[model samples]
Target: MAHDLTTPRDGIPPVLSTPASFREAAAALASGQGPLAIDTERASGFRYDDRAFLVQIRRRDVGTFLLDPEGHRTEFTAALAPVLNGQDWILHAAPSDLPSLAWLGLYPGSLFDTELGGRLAGLDHVNLAAMTELLLDVRLAKGHGAEDWSQRPLPANWLAYAALDVELLLELGDTMAEILDNQGKLDWASEEFEYIRNTHSTITGPAEATWRSVRGVASLTRPEQLAVARELWMIRESIAVEEDRAVSRILPNKVLIEIARLLPRTARELVRVKGFRRSEVRFWGEIIQRALESDPRTWPTRDRPPRGLPSRQTWAAEHPDSWERFSNARTLLDDLSADLAIPVENILKPAVLRTVAWGATVGREIRSPLDLPDVLRDYQARNWQVELTAPILTETLFR
Candidate 1:
């Protein structure tokens, strides 16, 4: 039975927020040996800026360091970025964390993503907690994952949770590497890690016209509903940005959708809608009415934005030949996945496969008969992936 992993073996380290402290932290880290195990805490749903407020790093000789990136921005960039870059890093779900770190000018020299390693090793569950239990026999307690990391003077328990993130990460990375080596997949994992490191963008801020991402917004097909949802989203965005609070705290997507659907005419009516609080109705009642009464021209002109790659389910009826080609290629991929013990998505990204299948069926022009490799590269398939799948795709798709 796996026991709960609660406290850090070294106890919770104090947060380093000052330039002087950051310099010391960098010095300490530089002296430590081996790859660094790192994690970052972000207020994704709680703040408009998805920046890493807190960064956790650990090494063998040096103890863990919890850094406040927001406190000493210039100092942090100058001090830690030098020590951090040009070193092998072990991260979990690096795609999520890399962008945030990169926003602060921190980049990894090379990476070993434990989560991706577990996936390559064909583990049933690859999350940090799951891998810990399976590989290290320790159960990590769950809490504070959704906390507002922007809050200053983080509580001790939250600090402990943060510390625990990196406490075992180095050990986990080592074990995961061993597993990959034994399975003859360390090279494959390396290629995937490099692809992720190179491809992830440093832009970490929320996107413009963000309302389209709200839950259930796509389900509302009516023009009026889309308009109301957009209005609510705009108001929520403004409030969240100005106040530095999560948009959901201002108005949850479900409540926004509810008000959009009902188009309530009065504060009394808006308050009655389930999930919408009366206090919110009193404050935004006028804004809601204006949205409903606004000129139809001002409303979102499109009911739903245009999307690429028609749904795969519709292909059988609308594009039978493409569907047949996709199905045949997908079957070959599945067999390859089983033989290689790699997930199909890991073998080739699903979107790339779909695009390739469709393009091949339509006789999309190519420079040469051996143009499959070039096409795969265009779709962001790495060299290792191309080596494994291009021949099979050429035989099944191009021919």
Candidate 2:
């Protein structure tokens, strides 16, 4: 009963790039009667931060409108503000799309993330195409997601692919809602959707964590290498923000790590290193060499602060008691996950589990089972999550 969704039933319209086009599209969409099915194409890994280049919105009868938001921010916002206001939105994976949309001043009133709903409904594959196929019996054509959407005069095939992104979302949302309601997870999914709607980030560029997040930064053995990598990462990040380009596209992780590893002393030496073939490498080498030549006295400590409890690798040998508790907790949580038909991550954040185990045993942060609520709250565990998990963890950590 599955058919390939190669094109929109009404066909793809022209990209609404101009103010007049946006207004017309808005008027058409506003007249349609239903929640909006929305999706955005962002150049995250390929460009800078998640800035949306294309926004696709669909309604019951309005069909699909591909919005070109670049260089027309004001027009795009002004025209569509009234249309999107106070309307529920259906998005496949809400988190990735929401940030860029928020950057464009588009916020949802209510959200139904089909991907999350699929997880709550206990579906195996929670991606957009997978959920649509399972719940709507329609297979979507994909493979355009990784392309640079900022290109003008977008290809016909890519447009069709983008159109299909929102085309089935309305029916898919309805079908998913019915399943969630039948499975008695409607309230849970509602809570999740509301959480996503309320929480959005409009950050345009890298934050403090950018350098540390580089692929091979953690693997560099020497403190000097980390210092050099951090410096090089900052240079890449600054240029990425200024030009609105992706950091990796500007300076690949493989090349950056190699330069840092070699501790290249000059622009000439820097360019000679392996994996340094970019056209900009010679120019970037000068700026990078400055960081490498700086005094080592100012270098940061080699060890970055742990994100959470001591690394689990060390827990067994360095902190055996906490390791044992963590082991037991995982087993208990895994069994609970199976019983409730919810993924382990959906039941409780993995960080919360690790922190709770360490807190109760080694950290001595929990005095008794009564202390579980406050500890869990610190991690922003949802009320429903805390309710479902508190008793289970209280017994596990305390015992």
Candidate 3:
């Protein structure tokens, strides 16, 4: 029978805001036995920064402890370092949470990422709620995750929800670990976990180029409009950061694009646009007008954005032989993925595969599967990934 988890087993502990409270919670966690179940709540969609507002931790004997990292940012790290350092951490989707946790100076010595484990074990629907229900038969209440956690005086219900995040994490980790071990993929999972733990989290790409990632920027054909969109995006980003609000919340992409396309000259013209009609125009109308009024000569160039490789369309047209090799490699990879019950992307990244295929045919020596490491050094294909897929890749290239 399925059980609905409405409240934490030991009830929600008070938010650890003060240094003394952090020390007390750390003491309890230190004395507790077994792996630490950890989760963090960040104000991502609602705030400018992605820092963790609430850090939730649970262990076998020590119930649940929620630390308000914002309250004691300076001291929380040192207080919990001894208890958390080198301990096995149980988390679902460790990559999403690890970076924010690392920002607080907390790093796990080892970790079991339940979601990745489930994927490796060939289980679909690996999200926390789904996996918990499938493996442990517990239904977690959904929603409330997107709330602005930076708000003072967090609600009691929200606290309960945060505590529940870590409630079944360790249990889920154990179940996934056992399944991986039985399937002889435990070593593979361990390597993946270690990689996640050691990897530093940093934003990629130039700040100016970040605007290009807006939803519909690809549709704009003119360099002037593209420049307008870039300027508007930069302006919105600046306001969002200063106000500590989400960029989308400040101005939706659709409205921003419309403003660029029309190049609204005045506050009256700007507010006439769909999303800018309300308080947004009153607040940011001047800035938008200024951006649109900038000289066209100063617009961004029409050159394609920098990328590691060309698109598949360009590759197929430019180099048919290398494309043939890539196609064959993909087929082989699909078969290997099906046989191993792991996703093809997990087996080898698509970019790495393409790079290897191109290099293999273009005067690069790849006598055996073993030489893949040298060819893939820059690509950073892991040993486990290369070991499983290289033989097939080698055959595809040589044949």
Best by TM-score: 2
lDDT of 3 by residue, 1-399 (tens): 778987787787788899999999999999999999999999978887688999999998878899997857878988998789788899999888887887777778788999999899988798888998999999987677889898989998899899999999988888998999999999998988887877743422223438878888877878777877887788888888799898778888899889777877777787789867566665666665565567878877655655545678987898788778879989989998898898888888887787788767654655656677666655766678867777778878766
TM-score of decoy 2: 0.90
Model 1: how far residue 134 lies from native, Å:
2.7
lDDT of 1 by residue, 1-399 (tens): 899978887788999899999999999999999999999999978787678999999998998999997967878989998999878999999998988888787888899999999999999899898999999999886588889898888998999999998888998999999999999999999999998887764453434658887888878777877888888888888888799887777888788888888888877788889888876666678777777788987777544466566776776888887787678888999998998788999989988888777767764654343878898988888888999888777777655
**Better structure of 1 and 2 per lDDT:** 1
| Alpha carbon lDDT of each predicted model | 0.85, 0.83, 0.82
lDDT per residue as tens, model 2, 1-399? 988888877887788888889999999998998899999987677677777899999998778899998889988988998789668899998988887777777788899999899998889999889888887889999999998888788999999999999988999999999999998889988988887777663443334556777777777878788888888888887888799888777778898888878887765777687767657766777766667678988775566656666676888999886787778778888998898789999989998888788878888877788988877878877778888889888766787
Q: Residue 140 in candidate 1 has what lDDT?
A: 81
Model 2 bad stretches (over 4 Å): 201-215, 218-227, 266-274, 278-281, 295-308, 317-321
| C-alpha lDDT of candidate 2 relative to the true structure | 0.83
Ordered by TM-score, highest first, the candidates read 2, 1, 3
Residue 59, model 1: Cα distance from true site in angstroms? 1.6
RMSD values, in order shown: 2.8, 2.8, 3.3
After superposing all C-alphas onto the true structure, candidate 3 shows an RMSD in angstroms of 3.3
Worst 10 residues of 2 by lDDT: 200-209
